[model samples]
Target: MKSLICLLFLALLSSPLLAQDIFSSKNTHFSFFSSSPLEDIEAKTEKGVSAINIKTKAIYFKVPIASFQFRQKLMQEHFNQNYLESDKYPYAEFKGKVLDDADLSKDGTYQVTVEGILNLHGVDKTYKEKGTITVKGGNITAGATFNIRIADHRIDIPTIVVKNIAEVVAVTVNALYTVVNR
Candidate 1:
């Protein structure tokens, strides 16, 4: 635990652009859905961690692939063993910056564009997406929805189950952050 804290501090201090203003959440909610002609699949997890620097408008997220829970045990098992390969690639991460002029210290909701690289299944992909950030009463709430192509991340599906899984999955992330490391 002490080493983890030290690492977190190192990560925050290593960023030259970030100011001292930081917000973080360990219980971030993340979900994904796939609707296809054969079957509709969905899964959700709250075991995500995220942090943001108000000064630099930089954001980061990390979620364990094994944390996501599906309704069926077989589906979860297949997802981890066959699709995501959680044993080999354990986590998904995102590093990006908010492209907006709004002051994060103020209280309001802002529609912001974020550009970042998402690493999933050991593959890194550049993404430019939009999300909502709301600052109120000294807390921050952020949410975003995006689509990820399974093939882009080298997550191959067997031909037999191709109809069950969609080529693209819709992902949603929500985090409520409070001031941290101050």
Candidate 2:
């Protein structure tokens, strides 16, 4: 009986359930674009961090608001100080789950919908966005594009420069993930 119990324990330890299920990317790319009649504003940053758990279908992402770089220095300054108020809300984060049951271990592309709360400018709003995830050779890559209304996040635009900024901005995210060794 003791031998049988030991065998079961060994089997459990070697099971696929015990394998690495978490994948992470430290340098995720995040960008946003605003188009208006006056001008178009764009910024991008690669300092974001993201993670996914294949077993639980959980996803998480966080990026510093001030890390975004604009083409013009003045625009970058205004974005951090006046629009985003980066000093007050240092980071924007998303915590959500993948709605699809895609086998991440397989090498294929999967369409996924993620529903989560996005905390930006100290306001939390729920968003459901569609994204594509490609798994190849034990690596995963995810890309998504979504729109965010400035009013939803309580971001106020001064009337004087209102024409330069759009009411809704297009946001794009890309991440290349590797398995997290435990």
Q: Per-residue lDDT for 57-121 in model 2, tens only?
A: 77888888999999999999999999899999988988888999898879999999999999999
Q: Candidate 2: TM-score?
A: 0.90
RMSD of 2: 9.1
Q: Worst lDDT window (10 residues) for model 1?
A: 1-10
Model 1: per-residue Cα lDDT over 63-161, one tens digit each: 889999999999999999999999999989888889889799999999999998999999999999999999999999999999999999999999999
Off by over 4 Å in 1: 1-9, 15-20
Give the TM-score of each candidate. Answer: 0.93, 0.90
Number of the top candidate by TM-score? 1
What's each prediction's clash count?
0, 0
> Cα lDDT of model 2 overall?
0.87
Model 2 segments beyond 4 Å from truth?
Answer: 1-19
How close is each model in CA RMSD to the real structure? 2.0, 9.1
